[model samples]
Target: MKRIALTVSAILLLFATAEPKQKKAQPKKQEATSVQQEAMKVLMSGFSTDPRFTWKTQQDEAQRICSQYPSMEAMPAQAIQKVIQLSQADLRYPQWGIFWGDWREGKKIVENPRGGRFASYGFSDSPTDKGGNCYACHLIEKGMPGGTMGPNLYQYGKRWNITKENMNTQEALERVKAVYNIIYNSWSAFPCSSMPRFGHNGALSPEDVMNIVTYLLHPDSPVNK
Candidate 1:
């Protein structure tokens, strides 16, 4: 028993005096930097720009600003306002004097899923391969399977007080312009919106945007009905 106790004491003493294993600190930011560089290199090697479609590989001023902040709430009011101002400066009004378009055509554009990231260079060369595909992000009609990425715009016109009954009124014109502005550059209205800048990026033409507006605001349109 005495010998066993002595052996145990010696073992305990050895353990108490033993050098502790040091945990190596991981340089997380450095590792992240290396991974990001590798990813960029891979992307650059794979993508080639063509006349019809080009990838926006480089970050723009607004994108850079937005990336630095996690969310719009985290961003400064001044910065948000600056994004709005910059976006508004790029706004292009419709060539036609009237903002309205045929809602029927608008419905076609909303449902069509052609020109977008999928239509980029080497994927499609058709000029008519572009459309709004608004239904992908909004529930604009009843019983239609739509993505829930954006808010339900089922009664957009009615909620906004836009109707065929109010079409010729001055209020309708102003509301039409407001919707036009949103479709043109959502960042103008919401500095860090997930919505695309359809008009600003030339993804959708002025006429195309007007058509979408008609689908949303027309009284007889499914969105309003």
Candidate 2:
């Protein structure tokens, strides 16, 4: 009887000791499984047509990185580096010798805001008559109001402060490149920037970009003057 009682007690003690370990392992396993399941859910979300009217080449890369983070997430540095290299490699400057055109024409391009066309793009000039749509994001001039989306461009040339040491012609050109890259490939500058890649998207010509740049950079231009 004593032997039987001892064996029973030993078995009960072994079960009692093992219970907490099993219980602790269960929640950890469940938490791990929950995390994995959540990741899978995000990765497997459905795709649809974006408002931009095209599934661009960089969209997949952007989505892949963006989906991993929580809402309002930024991309990793490695991914951003890849994006910058790709954007710069694909930076297509103005082929025509024309970089500056009439700023009056440029002004019209800024004011006219009626070029976004979906399936009904054929109702008007879809490709050629497209506006440069500057003021949509930028506050280009005091007379013209713009969305608060981008920074104010009023006296931007003077106020924006591009003061680098020894800002000679070469440095100026390099600064143009840096700024142009932002206007050309915003994703390169800021991975999650709301600014549109006007040149890259064929929304504006190089001449148009140049005129805008000239308006900002030229000492005589209103932006500087």
Candidate 3:
């Protein structure tokens, strides 16, 4: 009986010790959350307070949801659906409709590496700097250096089977619209994608996005060559 009582006492002591350790972990988690909040405040204070930049510091509904997960794989199904719904709902198209724009003009926007980036140190973008800076993430044309963060798009138009003979067909128009939607709001198709929502955020206008779509889907563009 004495031995059984000692065993019970040891088990009770273990439970008591484990309970405090579990309780202690809760405070550490709270402290970590506090630290993260403080860090965000410090980072936001470094940017200029210009009205144009105010949007950068603020998280929209979709952004607030996305910020909770580190990556798409970590996101819950409900969260992913919510983000996609929000992204699709916010899409806007050019008043002229979703037709091919000037591919040559589109090429300039694709290759030019200046636009939308803001800094106070003499590097702030001028209103005229409307380049998409696409080469930063994609290889649009042959012989052009580009990053590997995104898939190689050296012959994007050719891969899509876009040809001048059929470029005006309903199927081709559908393809054009699909690509346009992706550029305008990538999260509509890919929740939590690394691709920026250029048109959705006004970084690029609808016309600009249409031109980019033309650059990628028009057979005559160098992206097909």
Q: Tens digit of lDDT per residue, candidate 2, span 55-155?
A: 44234555444334333345566766776666666576666533334555555655667422222234554434666566777877767678778878776
Higher-ranked by TM-score: 1 or 3: 3
Best by TM-score: 3
Query: How high is the CA lDDT of each candidate model?
Result: 0.73, 0.56, 0.77
The digit string of per-residue lDDT tens for model 1 on 183-212 reads: 888998988798888887767777877888
Candidate 1's TM-score? 0.76
Q: In lDDT terms, which candidate is top? A: 3
Span of ten consecutive residues with least summed lDDT in model 2: 114-123
Model 2 error, position 56 (Å)? 6.0
Q: Candidate 2: RMSD over Cα atoms?
A: 16.6
Alpha-carbon error at 154 in model 2, in Å?
A: 1.5
What are the per-residue Cα lDDT tens digits for candidate 3 across 23-141? 46888656655655665565566668887666776778898777666578888899999999999999899898988898887887777786444323245445456777888998778
**Whole-structure CA lDDT of model 1:** 0.73
Q: Please list the Cα RMSD from the true structure of every candidate, rounded to 1 decimal place.
A: 15.2, 16.6, 13.0
